[model samples]
Target: MADQEPIALLLLQKCAQVEAAAGLVTAVRALHGPSRTAPIVLLTEAEAKTDPKSSSVDAAIPIHCPADHAARELERWRPVSLEPTRRIAGILGPGPIAGMIERLGVRLEAAMGMLAQERIDQGEAHRLAGLCGTLGFAQAHAAWLDLSLGEATSLAEARRTTRLTLAAIARGL
Candidate 1:
Protein backbone atom coordinates (compact mmCIF):
# COMPACT_ATOMS: atom_id res chain seq x y z
CA MET A 1 0.00 0.00 0.00
CA ALA A 2 3.00 2.32 0.38
CA ASP A 3 3.30 2.53 -3.42
CA GLN A 4 -0.41 3.12 -4.02
CA GLU A 5 -1.18 6.22 -6.01
CA PRO A 6 -3.01 9.09 -4.35
CA ILE A 7 -6.51 9.94 -5.57
CA ALA A 8 -7.84 13.49 -5.90
CA LEU A 9 -11.43 12.54 -6.60
CA LEU A 10 -13.11 9.15 -6.58
CA LEU A 11 -16.05 8.85 -8.95
CA LEU A 12 -18.16 5.72 -8.76
CA GLN A 13 -21.04 4.72 -10.99
CA LYS A 14 -24.25 3.47 -9.42
CA CYS A 15 -26.25 0.93 -11.41
CA ALA A 16 -29.16 -1.22 -10.30
CA GLN A 17 -28.06 -4.23 -12.35
CA VAL A 18 -24.58 -4.39 -10.68
CA GLU A 19 -23.86 -2.84 -7.28
CA ALA A 20 -20.13 -2.13 -7.09
CA ALA A 21 -20.09 1.09 -5.04
CA ALA A 22 -19.43 -0.50 -1.63
CA GLY A 23 -16.74 -2.81 -2.92
CA LEU A 24 -14.96 0.05 -4.67
CA VAL A 25 -15.10 2.26 -1.56
CA THR A 26 -13.67 -0.57 0.51
CA ALA A 27 -10.86 -1.08 -2.00
CA VAL A 28 -10.06 2.63 -1.95
CA ARG A 29 -9.95 2.68 1.85
CA ALA A 30 -7.75 -0.41 1.86
CA LEU A 31 -5.34 1.21 -0.58
CA HIS A 32 -5.32 4.76 0.84
CA GLY A 33 -6.43 4.11 4.45
CA PRO A 34 -9.58 5.35 6.12
CA SER A 35 -8.02 8.81 6.73
CA ARG A 36 -8.18 9.62 3.00
CA THR A 37 -10.37 12.71 2.63
CA ALA A 38 -10.72 12.77 -1.15
CA PRO A 39 -14.28 13.46 -2.24
CA ILE A 40 -16.24 10.47 -3.57
CA VAL A 41 -19.00 11.46 -5.95
CA LEU A 42 -21.49 8.95 -7.31
CA LEU A 43 -22.62 9.33 -10.91
CA THR A 44 -26.08 8.03 -11.61
CA GLU A 45 -28.83 8.29 -14.21
CA ALA A 46 -31.74 10.57 -13.36
CA GLU A 47 -34.09 7.62 -12.99
CA ALA A 48 -31.78 5.40 -10.92
CA LYS A 49 -33.71 3.82 -8.05
CA THR A 50 -30.82 3.47 -5.55
CA ASP A 51 -30.10 6.29 -3.12
CA PRO A 52 -26.52 7.25 -3.98
CA LYS A 53 -25.78 8.66 -0.52
CA SER A 54 -26.57 5.26 1.04
CA SER A 55 -23.37 3.98 -0.58
CA SER A 56 -21.30 6.27 1.73
CA VAL A 57 -20.28 8.61 -1.12
CA ASP A 58 -19.80 12.32 -0.46
CA ALA A 59 -22.22 13.51 -3.13
CA ALA A 60 -24.38 12.21 -5.98
CA ILE A 61 -24.85 14.02 -9.25
CA PRO A 62 -26.63 13.25 -12.51
CA ILE A 63 -24.49 12.09 -15.40
CA HIS A 64 -25.83 14.60 -17.92
CA CYS A 65 -25.86 17.77 -15.87
CA PRO A 66 -24.54 21.05 -17.28
CA ALA A 67 -20.77 21.35 -17.42
CA ASP A 68 -20.72 24.45 -15.25
CA HIS A 69 -22.98 22.80 -12.70
CA ALA A 70 -20.68 19.80 -12.48
CA ALA A 71 -17.63 22.00 -12.22
CA ARG A 72 -19.23 24.05 -9.46
CA GLU A 73 -20.04 20.90 -7.53
CA LEU A 74 -16.49 19.59 -7.93
CA GLU A 75 -15.11 22.94 -6.81
CA ARG A 76 -16.21 22.09 -3.30
CA TRP A 77 -13.39 19.54 -3.19
CA ARG A 78 -10.74 21.69 -4.89
CA PRO A 79 -11.22 25.44 -5.00
CA VAL A 80 -9.45 27.87 -7.29
CA SER A 81 -9.50 31.63 -6.90
CA LEU A 82 -9.90 33.53 -10.18
CA GLU A 83 -8.37 36.89 -9.39
CA PRO A 84 -7.95 39.76 -11.88
CA THR A 85 -4.30 38.94 -12.48
CA ARG A 86 -5.17 35.30 -13.21
CA ARG A 87 -8.00 36.32 -15.56
CA ILE A 88 -5.64 38.64 -17.45
CA ALA A 89 -3.04 35.91 -17.55
CA GLY A 90 -5.52 33.64 -19.32
CA ILE A 91 -5.66 36.24 -22.11
CA LEU A 92 -1.97 37.25 -22.33
CA GLY A 93 -0.16 34.37 -20.64
CA PRO A 94 1.99 34.61 -17.50
CA GLY A 95 4.30 37.54 -18.18
CA PRO A 96 4.10 41.27 -17.41
CA ILE A 97 0.32 41.20 -16.88
CA ALA A 98 0.76 40.50 -13.17
CA GLY A 99 3.15 43.41 -12.71
CA MET A 100 0.87 45.58 -14.84
CA ILE A 101 -2.19 44.77 -12.73
CA GLU A 102 -0.23 45.41 -9.52
CA ARG A 103 1.01 48.77 -10.81
CA LEU A 104 -2.48 49.76 -11.94
CA GLY A 105 -4.04 48.68 -8.65
CA VAL A 106 -1.50 50.72 -6.72
CA ARG A 107 -2.06 53.69 -8.98
CA LEU A 108 -5.83 53.44 -8.58
CA GLU A 109 -5.46 53.35 -4.81
CA ALA A 110 -3.19 56.38 -4.94
CA ALA A 111 -5.66 58.24 -7.15
CA MET A 112 -8.41 57.55 -4.65
CA GLY A 113 -6.24 58.92 -1.87
CA MET A 114 -5.50 62.02 -3.93
CA LEU A 115 -9.20 62.54 -4.61
CA ALA A 116 -9.90 62.22 -0.91
CA GLN A 117 -7.41 64.99 -0.23
CA GLU A 118 -8.89 67.20 -3.03
CA ARG A 119 -5.52 67.06 -4.77
CA ILE A 120 -6.67 65.30 -7.94
CA ASP A 121 -7.43 67.44 -11.01
CA GLN A 122 -9.20 66.90 -14.33
CA GLY A 123 -5.90 66.22 -16.10
CA GLU A 124 -5.05 63.37 -13.73
CA ALA A 125 -8.62 62.05 -14.04
CA HIS A 126 -8.34 61.96 -17.84
CA ARG A 127 -5.03 60.13 -17.66
CA LEU A 128 -6.40 57.58 -15.23
CA ALA A 129 -9.43 57.04 -17.46
CA GLY A 130 -7.16 56.33 -20.46
CA LEU A 131 -5.05 53.90 -18.44
CA CYS A 132 -8.11 52.07 -17.11
CA GLY A 133 -9.57 51.79 -20.63
CA THR A 134 -6.32 50.34 -21.94
CA LEU A 135 -6.30 47.84 -19.07
CA GLY A 136 -9.89 46.68 -19.84
CA PHE A 137 -11.40 48.03 -16.62
CA ALA A 138 -14.59 49.43 -18.07
CA GLN A 139 -16.20 50.37 -14.77
CA ALA A 140 -13.08 52.19 -13.56
CA HIS A 141 -12.83 53.91 -16.94
CA ALA A 142 -16.43 55.08 -16.60
CA ALA A 143 -15.82 56.41 -13.10
CA TRP A 144 -12.78 58.31 -14.31
CA LEU A 145 -14.80 59.65 -17.20
CA ASP A 146 -17.38 61.06 -14.82
CA LEU A 147 -14.65 62.62 -12.68
CA SER A 148 -12.91 64.14 -15.71
CA LEU A 149 -16.16 65.57 -17.03
CA GLY A 150 -16.91 67.23 -13.67
CA GLU A 151 -20.13 65.24 -13.43
CA ALA A 152 -19.47 64.15 -9.82
CA THR A 153 -21.18 66.39 -7.29
CA SER A 154 -18.13 66.51 -5.02
CA LEU A 155 -14.59 65.21 -4.66
CA ALA A 156 -15.81 62.82 -1.96
CA GLU A 157 -18.39 61.39 -4.34
CA ALA A 158 -15.73 60.93 -6.97
CA ARG A 159 -13.53 59.13 -4.49
CA ARG A 160 -16.39 56.86 -3.47
CA THR A 161 -17.15 55.91 -7.07
CA THR A 162 -13.48 55.38 -7.83
CA ARG A 163 -13.10 53.12 -4.78
CA LEU A 164 -16.13 51.08 -5.82
CA THR A 165 -14.94 50.70 -9.42
CA LEU A 166 -11.42 49.75 -8.39
CA ALA A 167 -12.81 47.20 -5.93
CA ALA A 168 -14.91 45.65 -8.69
CA ILE A 169 -11.88 45.42 -10.98
CA ALA A 170 -9.89 43.76 -8.17
CA ARG A 171 -12.67 41.16 -7.87
CA GLY A 172 -11.99 40.00 -11.49
CA LEU A 173 -15.16 41.56 -12.93
Candidate 2:
Protein backbone atom coordinates (compact mmCIF):
# COMPACT_ATOMS: atom_id res chain seq x y z
CA MET A 1 0.00 0.00 0.00
CA ALA A 2 2.97 2.31 0.43
CA ASP A 3 3.61 2.06 -3.29
CA GLN A 4 0.04 3.19 -3.82
CA GLU A 5 0.87 6.56 -2.34
CA PRO A 6 1.32 9.41 -4.78
CA ILE A 7 4.76 9.30 -6.33
CA ALA A 8 4.74 12.80 -7.77
CA LEU A 9 2.61 15.64 -9.07
CA LEU A 10 2.98 16.37 -12.77
CA LEU A 11 1.79 19.77 -13.98
CA LEU A 12 1.48 20.57 -17.65
CA GLN A 13 2.46 24.08 -18.66
CA LYS A 14 1.02 25.25 -21.92
CA CYS A 15 2.58 28.01 -24.09
CA ALA A 16 5.66 28.45 -21.88
CA GLN A 17 3.89 30.19 -18.98
CA VAL A 18 6.26 29.44 -16.13
CA GLU A 19 4.58 31.93 -13.80
CA ALA A 20 1.32 29.99 -14.06
CA ALA A 21 3.16 26.76 -13.42
CA ALA A 22 4.86 28.24 -10.40
CA GLY A 23 1.55 29.41 -9.02
CA LEU A 24 0.05 25.97 -9.51
CA VAL A 25 3.01 24.38 -7.80
CA THR A 26 2.54 26.71 -4.84
CA ALA A 27 -1.15 25.88 -4.63
CA VAL A 28 -0.46 22.16 -4.81
CA ARG A 29 2.15 22.35 -2.08
CA ALA A 30 -0.16 24.33 0.13
CA LEU A 31 -3.02 21.90 -0.35
CA HIS A 32 -0.93 18.78 0.09
CA GLY A 33 1.12 20.15 3.01
CA PRO A 34 4.40 21.88 2.34
CA SER A 35 6.33 19.04 3.88
CA ARG A 36 4.96 16.42 1.48
CA THR A 37 7.68 14.12 0.15
CA ALA A 38 6.13 13.54 -3.26
CA PRO A 39 7.98 15.72 -5.74
CA ILE A 40 6.23 18.11 -8.11
CA VAL A 41 7.40 17.96 -11.72
CA LEU A 42 6.49 20.52 -14.35
CA LEU A 43 6.14 19.60 -17.97
CA THR A 44 6.66 22.68 -20.14
CA GLU A 45 6.89 23.52 -23.77
CA ALA A 46 10.30 23.17 -25.37
CA GLU A 47 11.02 26.89 -25.18
CA ALA A 48 9.81 27.35 -21.60
CA LYS A 49 12.63 28.26 -19.24
CA THR A 50 11.68 27.21 -15.75
CA ASP A 51 14.01 26.87 -12.80
CA PRO A 52 12.27 24.23 -10.71
CA LYS A 53 14.40 24.65 -7.58
CA SER A 54 13.55 28.34 -7.43
CA SER A 55 9.82 27.63 -7.72
CA SER A 56 9.56 24.69 -5.26
CA VAL A 57 9.17 22.14 -8.06
CA ASP A 58 11.54 19.21 -7.90
CA ALA A 59 12.12 19.07 -11.66
CA ALA A 60 11.04 20.73 -14.91
CA ILE A 61 11.30 18.86 -18.15
CA PRO A 62 10.50 19.94 -21.67
CA ILE A 63 7.66 18.02 -23.28
CA HIS A 64 9.80 17.52 -26.36
CA CYS A 65 12.77 16.03 -24.54
CA PRO A 66 13.94 12.51 -25.33
CA ALA A 67 11.98 9.71 -23.70
CA ASP A 68 15.01 8.48 -21.78
CA HIS A 69 15.69 11.94 -20.39
CA ALA A 70 12.07 12.27 -19.27
CA ALA A 71 12.19 8.85 -17.67
CA ARG A 72 15.41 9.76 -15.88
CA GLU A 73 13.80 12.90 -14.47
CA LEU A 74 10.79 10.94 -13.22
CA GLU A 75 13.02 8.32 -11.66
CA ARG A 76 14.97 11.05 -9.89
CA TRP A 77 11.77 12.11 -8.19
CA ARG A 78 10.52 8.61 -7.33
CA PRO A 79 10.40 7.90 -3.62
CA VAL A 80 12.94 5.44 -2.33
CA SER A 81 11.50 2.30 -0.72
CA LEU A 82 11.87 2.11 3.04
CA GLU A 83 14.45 -0.35 4.27
CA PRO A 84 13.17 -3.25 6.35
CA THR A 85 14.61 -2.04 9.63
CA ARG A 86 13.08 -3.07 12.93
CA ARG A 87 11.31 0.25 13.29
CA ILE A 88 9.89 -0.02 9.81
CA ALA A 89 8.78 -3.58 10.44
CA GLY A 90 7.04 -2.46 13.61
CA ILE A 91 5.22 0.21 11.70
CA LEU A 92 4.50 -1.73 8.52
CA GLY A 93 4.03 -5.15 10.13
CA PRO A 94 6.09 -8.31 9.85
CA GLY A 95 4.72 -9.36 6.45
CA PRO A 96 7.12 -7.11 4.57
CA ILE A 97 10.18 -8.43 6.38
CA ALA A 98 10.22 -11.81 4.70
CA GLY A 99 9.51 -10.21 1.33
CA MET A 100 12.35 -7.77 1.81
CA ILE A 101 14.74 -10.54 2.69
CA GLU A 102 13.76 -12.52 -0.42
CA ARG A 103 14.19 -9.46 -2.59
CA LEU A 104 17.60 -8.75 -1.09
CA GLY A 105 18.66 -12.32 -1.77
CA VAL A 106 17.62 -12.00 -5.40
CA ARG A 107 19.46 -8.71 -5.74
CA LEU A 108 22.56 -10.22 -4.16
CA GLU A 109 22.51 -13.10 -6.60
CA ALA A 110 22.23 -10.71 -9.51
CA ALA A 111 25.06 -8.61 -8.13
CA MET A 112 27.20 -11.68 -7.77
CA GLY A 113 26.57 -12.56 -11.40
CA MET A 114 27.51 -9.04 -12.39
CA LEU A 115 30.61 -9.25 -10.23
CA ALA A 116 31.65 -12.48 -11.96
CA GLN A 117 31.33 -10.78 -15.32
CA GLU A 118 33.17 -7.69 -14.11
CA ARG A 119 30.09 -5.65 -14.95
CA ILE A 120 29.07 -4.49 -11.50
CA ASP A 121 29.41 -0.76 -11.10
CA GLN A 122 30.46 0.97 -7.91
CA GLY A 123 27.07 2.59 -7.46
CA GLU A 124 25.27 -0.78 -7.51
CA ALA A 125 27.88 -2.34 -5.26
CA HIS A 126 27.47 0.46 -2.75
CA ARG A 127 23.71 0.18 -2.82
CA LEU A 128 23.85 -3.58 -2.31
CA ALA A 129 26.26 -3.05 0.56
CA GLY A 130 23.82 -0.73 2.26
CA LEU A 131 20.97 -3.21 1.71
CA CYS A 132 23.09 -5.97 3.22
CA GLY A 133 23.75 -3.89 6.28
CA THR A 134 20.08 -3.05 6.64
CA LEU A 135 19.20 -6.76 6.38
CA GLY A 136 21.82 -7.58 9.07
CA PHE A 137 24.19 -9.39 6.75
CA ALA A 138 27.36 -7.83 8.10
CA GLN A 139 29.81 -10.09 6.31
CA ALA A 140 27.95 -9.62 3.06
CA HIS A 141 28.04 -5.88 3.62
CA ALA A 142 31.81 -6.00 4.12
CA ALA A 143 32.25 -8.11 1.00
CA TRP A 144 30.13 -5.64 -0.98
CA LEU A 145 32.33 -2.83 0.30
CA ASP A 146 35.39 -4.73 -0.79
CA LEU A 147 33.92 -5.03 -4.25
CA SER A 148 32.76 -1.45 -4.34
CA LEU A 149 36.11 -0.07 -3.20
CA GLY A 150 38.19 -2.36 -5.39
CA GLU A 151 39.81 -3.95 -2.35
CA ALA A 152 39.19 -7.52 -3.48
CA THR A 153 42.33 -8.61 -5.32
CA SER A 154 41.20 -11.19 -7.88
CA LEU A 155 38.19 -12.74 -9.58
CA ALA A 156 38.59 -15.78 -7.33
CA GLU A 157 38.37 -13.59 -4.26
CA ALA A 158 35.26 -11.93 -5.61
CA ARG A 159 33.71 -15.33 -6.22
CA ARG A 160 34.56 -16.41 -2.72
CA THR A 161 32.97 -13.32 -1.26
CA THR A 162 29.89 -13.87 -3.36
CA ARG A 163 29.57 -17.43 -2.09
CA LEU A 164 30.01 -16.31 1.48
CA THR A 165 27.38 -13.62 1.03
CA LEU A 166 24.99 -16.18 -0.44
CA ALA A 167 25.59 -18.42 2.52
CA ALA A 168 24.85 -15.60 4.91
CA ILE A 169 21.61 -14.90 3.12
CA ALA A 170 20.70 -18.58 3.30
CA ARG A 171 21.38 -18.57 7.03
CA GLY A 172 18.71 -15.85 7.38
CA LEU A 173 20.46 -14.08 10.21
**TM-scores of the models, in the given order?**
0.41, 0.41
Which lDDT tens digits does candidate 2 get at residues 45-107? 763443322345434688898999888866644432333344556776667766877788678
In model 1, the Cα lDDT at residue 34 comes to: 19
Model 2, TM vs. native: 0.41
Candidate 1: the clashing residue pairs are none
lDDT of 1 by residue, 58-169 (tens): 5667788898987876664441123543566778875666566567767876785576455657888888888766666655677687788886554543443454444434
Predicted structure with the largest lDDT when compared to the true one: 1
Worst 10 residues of 2 by lDDT: 1-10
The whole-model lDDT of each prediction reads 0.59, 0.57
Off by over 4 Å in 1: 1-88, 152-157, 165-173
Please state the error at residue 161 of candidate 2 in Å. 3.7
